[model samples]
Target chain A: MTDPQRIWTAAAVIIGDEILSGRTHDKNIAQIATWLQVQGIRLTEVRVIADDMDAIAEAVNTLRAKHDYLFTTGGIGPTHDDITVDAVAAALGIEVIIHPEARAMLEDYYETRGGLNEGRLRMARVPAGSDLIPNRYTGAPGIRLGNLFLMAGVPHITAGMLDGLTGELEGGAPLLSEVIGSWVPESEVAILLRDVEQAHEGCQIGSYPFFREGRSGANFVIRSTDPDVLQSCVDTLCEGLGELGWDFTPGGI
Target chain B: MTDPQRIWTAAAVIIGDEILSGRTHDKNIAQIATWLQVQGIRLTEVRVIADDMDAIAEAVNTLRAKHDYLFTTGGIGPTHDDITVDAVAAALGIEVIIHPEARAMLEDYYETRGGLNEGRLRMARVPAGSDLIPNRYTGAPGIRLGNLFLMAGVPHITAGMLDGLTGELEGGAPLLSEVIGSWVPESEVAILLRDVEQAHEGCQIGSYPFFREGRSGANFVIRSTDPDVLQSCVDTLCEGLGELGWDFTPGGI
Candidate 1:
């Protein structure tokens, strides 16, 4: 039987030297994770490797073997460092060639601006048996091979490509979450929290310990699919905290 | 022969339900990466696992085996959901009991507030043979076991602990990077860029493709330990970009 809310796992491979050098703070991993969570697809791991062919290929194969889907970002451009397609082909034991559609896009991109340069032709080289992922941001398209969606590293371009393909893919129902805010410290209310968690077998509870000035506190979020069960737990929690003169509000689903 | 600058490969194991659920975006990885880079330590991998005991234990054992140093964040709070200490003990095949030092800190934290609750006592549990990592933010001290640095998930607190320990750890010299920026499209300036890279054997060069208005461009950064080599490469890059009629600038160190 097929589960509608099936949690599919993904391994995101971020290829770039900039991220490693701390020149670029990566925005893709968090963006992708948020998108996947809404679809009930779990981003299991994220690997940020350099533009080296060996490193990219090694991480590609390793991630592909462990995950249901492998999403790679970066190294698909008109330059020497843009070797993602070549590296992916090497990892998949396939040939690298320009697809008819990609060639057309490349020709159109260059012709629209006058003529094609030899360097511009390099962006058309894609892994064999791959489908073109439309890039609305720029003319250089993304590629999809099996479960791997090879995207551009630039945040806007990557976002555009992902948005374009969202409607075509099979995804899970979005997971819902609920949270309760409080000003009670974790240390002051530890046992009551533990008992609440043990009593609610269906929900997953988390404590976020925070501090304002010298005063310490926590925000406890109880998560579950059943809204009724979640509310009941929250009610009990509020009562427990109220008795101790602790500040808390309705939270979690 | 021992290298003058010790570069220990480190893996960060982030244990939290909030991070996994997409409720919180991680600030620790970037902060830690910056800290380690400055200290000459390399962060090779990062794994964000849930608060499940099995998952935490598995990640701890796996990471500790591969990397020279393993830094874990989250699940060290006083709450029952905070299972890092016990999980680390289970992973290392050791016992977890109330460490005298941890207990003393807890006693002080509670005694200052009149008297201690049983829930507060849970914070004292530590894996056998591990030394305490003094926390300057709050009294709840972190622990260190061999290469493993158990730390708080809170950004400010985690940074404080890492900062305190930085002077003691051996590290490589901070990597230097020189960014040569240009507004020309990547395709237009690919050949000369490749020539510049081929000429600079000592430096590592990268292209950061970006788009402004309707035109696309790239920022080429040359990185190396040798200042002369880096400057030479930067000069070649500026000359190349200048030939393309793109505005060039020396961005950073």
Candidate 2:
């Protein structure tokens, strides 16, 4: 495999009070991370902050500046508290404007319902000169401004928007992983795993241990952008475990 | 209640490659956030970073300086990949050493299973001058260094550590919440929620919309530090919803 200087990376800012308050459990971090991975873009960092405009703006500025791409979820609905667009716009030193296409879409969607009211019109607002990401689940569209995409807080709605955005991103090679699980305590085989990972040119190993079924066990996940390298790292680790007389499962327990 | 300039806040740095790679869904953020709320310490920010030493150390330094307390979960296990101890020690410019109590606990816990070997001895290591947070689920005790805590990546083990450290930290008044759920779409009642919240000082309302029972619904959570004020806010919100001809459920949907 050829050497690469850096991997394409994305950072997510989860904007909401519910998540931080623990009233609502956050699923967006995992979702966005998974989606970015499939696109060959690694999600490197995630910050869950409150709905405060200043906090949102500061986080947006910091993350967008640092990563190749940035995403924000929450505070995009048709409510007074939904302030992501305004916050993001302020951060970028731009104005918040109602996107005509978004307004038209909402108008059409609400035609049979109650029609677009002043509150419903809030969903049409976006950072100046931004486009829209289609939302098949709900009428309000996800906003996209350059490399920063603002999505929904709702898990299923976020999934829909992500689906609409699949393959729309430019990314590098996708990372491949192979998992090996064993009842052996991770401490017993830490060195073996590390040595195997070090021996492999482009692979890294992650150990996740758990106490389950009345026994201590761990799953070793070997990751590499190259599928062949990932496979070889897994094989080497498996061979070492076999030599140690430790029983392991190939696909994880 | 008097308006406070800043709430006692804490930030969490989840250090692991599994979470970033989406191979593992993070539960520590919610667990820690919930635990902090009960202790009157608001979990203001959470940054999930990679297993890289530089990233973990930088995040720990940045957040520890910003908040009253900072927590890190994951990479505290008995594996080579578990470098949280080494990374945090580097960040604090401290040395790493084996804590005698932790070593003794491991020795006792593993006496019948397997004696403390080199691999298991990894669990005994801690940053210089640190104390141990007891773990009932496992032998590896959580590390406590000043206002920073290093905890296990596993949910149950982390829970055990949290249980052991409950009420140990100093904090302010706990934030209280009241939930009012309705079948009405949030946009239809956005203005009402805003008006009620505006009229109620020291209170903020968050709207969470969901789809259930083949219809769209929303839950408005009113939060405040004062119980009387929280109750008043909930009462006002309920009155507003009733006036709008919407049937609502108390305590959320």
Candidate 3:
């Protein structure tokens, strides 16, 4: 997301059978990836694994060691199907313990609603030396075990955890981007896109095509850690598009 | 997605900068996963990586060797940024060659639209010793090199390729499922879900909670490779729900 020497990378482990079964469409991957960019960390890789404990441990252990940070979602709800905490603990070679603060928080939150029971208490289990990532909307706080952050599977609940983590992690310069949308089919200007991308060192361009308004269109997204370089790439692309006689929108359509 | 003893698993490599940058929400993972399930292959792992060559190769090589099958989506378009073919070729220690049939397909398809150009020809390239997966909608065919399937990032085009692939690969019995939606908080019925899942050796029930129509509700999805086990699990869950004095919708809300 920043200088080559200082780029911060993160990997996400999405733990759920529902996702792998295609019963639930994933929303956390995009949300977390977007949020990590604001924190100046590049979301380098993501793994969507099932609810299996061995799979969970294997993924978490592999990713947590390779990247600067690893974030996991799902398998931490009230039901028996929710076994993320146990799996992660097994992976880390640590004992699962009831997090006192989290237990207290849940106790207080559920006090006004239904009293906290054994099923709800499942939310309090975490690795022996883990900390809590605050959750504003729900009783269960996200788990932070060293470099690994265990979050909720629900999109909105994961948003609450991310909101609590804004500007918290150490990261490098933020990645900046500029998008140019045009009606011209990307194939028409493929050479031009290639030349522009090659001309910039710190920048990379992505072409996303869409069919809208009964015609083909594309959004050319230029990304770079350096704002000046990004702008220059955008300018050069715009000039090339102009020379090609393609009407373009500065942002996206 | 099938019998536990004969379970077949797959991993997907989503090659793109757009996905990691959060510019595009990926639809391919769910589509492929659902398709894989119907074929009795479990979608075990998914990796969303950048457009970098090394990253792509590392992911492809690692996943292709580990799983029974590996799929890749994105970076197969007609632009320079579309380098999935080259990257995958490098991964398998093979050279990138233009398949003559794919080249001819493009020539015929583009004859009525625009003449085939150098940019358009890029789609014809594939790893050495690869076969074609038919594309009924687009000119460029999907690539199949042994267990690795190189597919389009676009949803509908990938659908066409998948359609061509139906009943082609050997698979076990398909996983069956039944869903029961109830207007009860998940915490209230966690024990019931646990008991039902335990009673059925081969079945698993996942609780997906949602808030709708001024009430909290959950969908208990019971899944198993055996249809009878799945149905029994669903029936047991329904009986439990009835015993708990909770009304449930048979399918889902």
Candidate 4:
């Protein structure tokens, strides 16, 4: 029989030379991931590529086809390297066009700032048959083509764009998670974690070990779509840790 | 004509669940990218995937075949969730074996602490015909099979592994970059930046716009393999910015 619960997955292509060059730390991956989680979509994979058109197009095409939704950030500005629109259009095998609403927004925003120039006008370009994702912070609206979303590279601007798209997409049940932290080495409790996870049908446990303040510790994150399964798994894990003489914090360390 | 300079490229596959869940912010991508730059290798692409065997193996196979070198971080711990070795072995179509050296190191490390158990012993497992990358911080050495390097998920442990591999790989000329920051909107100077970049044969400019302290500004990073070309490009850009009556910081603001 087919699965009762539909799993919605998404992928993000972070297009920027600055990030690949290590000149800029990317904040969009986590930002978008968190946003997608809230939207009941799981972010399955993320690829960070350069500003090159071929690379951008290849990543966009490949990821957009594989996942339920694809999000791209960066290369949507007015600079020469801002070739996301062209690359995405090429990826979709379509022409790039200026959205009337986007152009009007740019014109209105830039009217008192400096008026639209060739560079500013470039912000209006998008893939053919696309809608606009509003950018409350910037004049340039984000482009949305089918299941593809092109957002700003700037973290706060991307945040604004994500805010605009919230509740607009259809997704499955949101994955729920719980964390338990303890001052114990993960190796000591590996078997217990494995056993507990296997015993719970839908729950998966992730162990994150850390060495802090001259001591070893770990935080166990348990995830499941079902709340009942999630709670039972957490209880079993806590019981197992207690049996092993380890103290664990429910909310993590 | 064959180019004398060989451009070395690398791709990274970050295997983890915490990162995908947005429960943990990834620090390895930037850290690895910066380290690769110092080794004169360009990190062309990076994929962050969940800790699933199929996902890990697929990403490994695809990226390792495409780039000069491939690096994977995460999923190398002692827990059941640490499946990087198995995934990588499957990807390479090799059998997993316990490296004697790694096993001995783990035994020695755990002698006073707790003695090697099944979980701790799991750290010694590696793909066949593999060499070890020294991990000074922990007993578990990173596994190196051919051009693939599997490192720890922890940032500090990964840093130690990267240190052990520095200057060991063959590479081309290191890319050099200079940044110029100005209190000007990028769109206002987009044409000048484009023209200046086009005039320079080998240099590529990346514009990063920012709105800070109630002012709009941008930092233009100019990169080139040749130091002479890089300096010339920077001089030309500074001159162009000056000609436009805008003052720019040489070392960036």
Interface RMSD of each: 2.5, 1.1, 1.3, 0.6
Model 4: per-residue lDDT, tens digit, B1-253? 4254889999999999899888889999999999999998999999999999999999999998899999999999999899999999998899999999999999999988889988999999999999999999989999888899999999999999999999999888899999999999999999999998999998999999999999899999999999888999999999989998999998898
lDDT score for candidate 3 against the true structure:
0.89
TM-score of each: 0.90, 0.97, 0.95, 0.98
Worst 10 residues of 2 chain B by lDDT: B1-10
If you score just chain A, what TM-score does every candidate get?
Answer: 0.87, 0.96, 0.95, 0.98
Highest TM-score, which number?
4
Q: Pull out the clashing pairs in model 4.
A: none
Kindly report which residue stretches of model 3 are placed more than 4 angstroms away from their true locations once superposed: A1-5, B1-5
Query: What residue runs in model 2 are displaced by over 4 Å at the alpha carbon?
Result: A1-6, B1-6
* lDDT tens readout by residue for model 1, A1-253: 6686466787788888777656687788777777777656777677677788897898899889988888899999888788899999998999999788888888887887656787788888888899999999677899998889999999888888888777666665555556777877778888888888788767667888888877766788886656777777777888898998987766521
How far in Å is the alpha carbon of A84 misplaced in model 4?
0.3
- Among all windows of ten consecutive residues in candidate 2 chain A, which has the lowest summed lDDT? A1-10
Per-residue CA lDDT of model 1 for B53-125, tens digit only, reads 8988988898799878889999888888999999999989999988898888878867777456776777788
Tens-place lDDT per residue, model 2, A43-131, is 98888899989999999999999998999999999888999999999999999888999999999999988999989999999989999
Which residue pairs in model 2 clash with each other? none
Query: DockQ of candidates 1 onward, in order?
Result: 0.52, 0.79, 0.72, 0.85
Proportion of the native interface contacts kept in model 3: 0.72
- Model 4, A68-123: lDDT tens digits are 99999999999999999998898788999889999999999999998999999999
lDDT of 4 at A22: 85
